[model samples]
Target: MLRQLGSGAQYLATDINQHAAETTQATLEAHGVHADVIVTDIMSGLDKRLAGMVDVAVVNPPYVPTHVEEVGCRGIAASWAVGLNGRQVIDRILPAVREMLSERGWLYMVALEDNDPSDICHLMSEMGNLREMFQIDAADYMMSICGDDSLKELSSPGKSGSIFYLSQDERFVIKTLRKTELKILLKLLPKYYNHVRAYDNTLITNFFWRPQDYSERRKKGSLCCDEKYVLH
Candidate 1:
């Protein structure tokens, strides 16, 4: 899929197992695609060449919890033998990938529910310096308010009865609001915006947009308001 979507981009794939690397190379060749495939433990040895230069990365590491001894074993068992919380390989891969990512780089990783994906996200946020990544300036605020499609659904049906979404660049969070909440927010929006604009070091959440009605034209129910939150 990366080959299909990312035309003209340099592609590099790594596997600890030599056979797996060869298989990946064969698959690419069969499809008339060319990519560099290496037999190494997740981005090893290529760090010097690719560090802080990778634009996009996709990882499908071994995530099945098994005995520690099975982790580095040869053949098929090595594919799914993640030690303990299914994060042995995943934990190692995260930092390496972090270092390889450019400022605008994006990572797509496969994780099971048991692997605690949420915690992984938090870890990446900290490692990637989310304060800088999520910082919203005046121009960014205007663009987001003008109906940017970067806001993709993150999660839904939270304890607050709201749906949460994160921007594609992970710069902003969009949260659905209830009718009553929207009314209160609308009432204070002017004052809130003024205060935030006046004080650069304010601790208040930076709200980029007012409530946006997202109800379908044919829908008979109340309009759903999506509130955009920029963490600055």
Candidate 2:
């Protein structure tokens, strides 16, 4: 994504581990991409400068339910360890993400059923009135596509350990699915396309895949799930 952002765009990345930060820099170098990588715990030191300047924010936070002590280990556990109800880090970052997002910014996050995805969206909406201006209109648009007032109901079980959720704007989605889920989606793609064509008002747009292996991609601690798919 940083590669596609162009040289003029400022791409910034953060991680708690210094090694992870350096590894990210090396990967970017190998890909001919450039970004300002920092070792900080979820925007800790840069929030003030980045406030309201981020046009796009993507977060694949730690969502696995575990003990509090397992939340912030320095080793590989940093990649997936989360606290009670799987919300330790997620709860902390929500406010920061809300404060940093530009007026038109969009956030794409990966969530689990235990995270209470609906409440997460609602919390974000309530934070500093993020959705106060667009609540009524956004609700109407959301209903046109989802046929309901709540976007949460659109969620369906995708795999053994994951689910999927689309935002009110239909711009991006929070998903975690498996290769089996991808296969089912591929089989239904034709009908889905036809339905979108028939309505001509939805946002089920774009489909593409990277050449890299999905498991190898996740080893980098990316949010891209097993056999990842992005429904724009």
Task: Give the Cα lDDT of each candidate.
Answer: 0.66, 0.61
lDDT of 2: 0.61
Candidate 1 runs further than 4 Å off: 1-7, 130-232
How many clashing pairs in candidate 1?
0
Worst 10 residues of 2 by lDDT: 205-214
Error of 2 at 13 (Å): 0.2
Q: Which stretches of candidate 2 lie over 4 Å from their true place?
A: 130-232
lDDT of 2 by residue, 1-232 (tens): 7677788778888987888889989998999997888887787646447766788888888798888788658688877788778876776677678766877998888989998898778756654352332232332322332323323424545446664556566643545555456546544644654565466555654332111123543566643455443232
Specify the highest-lDDT model's number: 1
lDDT of 1 by residue, 126-204 (tens): 5444223336343454344333365676665677767777766676677777645754664464466557557778887
TM-score of 2: 0.54
Scored against the true structure, residue 90 in model 2 reaches a CA lDDT of 79
Give me candidate 1's TM-score against the actual structure.
0.54
